[model samples]
Target: MTVSLHTRRRQSGVTLLGLLMWAIVLGFGALIVMKVVPTIIEYSTISKAVNKIAAEGLSTVPEIRAAFDRQKDIDYGITSITSRDLDITKENDKVVIRFAYNKEVELFSPVFLLIKYQGTSRTTTR
Candidate 1:
């Protein structure tokens, strides 16, 4: 009597190279998130400050800039732009505050990420 030969089933899973590649991708993603989140938070803080100052009825440009400086001093997150960087304007009897800045993040020794942030506050009565 002849015995039947059994066939081996192929394993389905990540190989060593695939696993390493995935690990590298995930690591880079984590690094970018860690670097970019703080900038986003700082931008939010700046936006809130601008909106609040615009609504506070500061008619003069100096007053608005000073208020922003005070707020920046209180909130340590605001560093990318200063009070002087603000572009204050009035439109339709409403105060508007605009700001723009650039943030450069270093990914490695030679690689960098440049982010440009710009925002304007809601028009409010001065």
Candidate 2:
């Protein structure tokens, strides 16, 4: 079968346009993923810390308070944390910890927006 060059060119343009559209959609998806991923990671980390204390037998607000040794950061949106001992807890009683941090992020991929991420962590003694 013989096809016209004009027809082929037109088809090419259409393919290009479709590809561009797909790129746009994917870009937005990537942007959103980036914005949300950090929150998930931060919260998970904090949660893990709480669980660690929980496994250690740190249960109760006072025990948590006593065990909580670091401020790390306040929950204002996108908080940074460095692990450290700010407080002290008993060796075998029940100990627990609770805290929150905020994450602030801006996105510009296939879309543009600013979002604030609020996350908290809690752990109890097993």
Best by lDDT: 1
The lDDT for every candidate, in the order shown, is 0.94, 0.52
**TM-scores for all candidates?**
0.93, 0.49
Q: Model 1, which residues run further than 4 Å from truth?
A: 1-7
Please identify model 2 stretches exceeding 4 Å from their true place.
1-14, 71-105, 108-126
- For model 1 the TM-score comes to 0.93
Clashing pairs in 1: none
Which model scores highest in TM-score?
1
Candidate RMSDs in Å, in order, are 2.0, 7.5
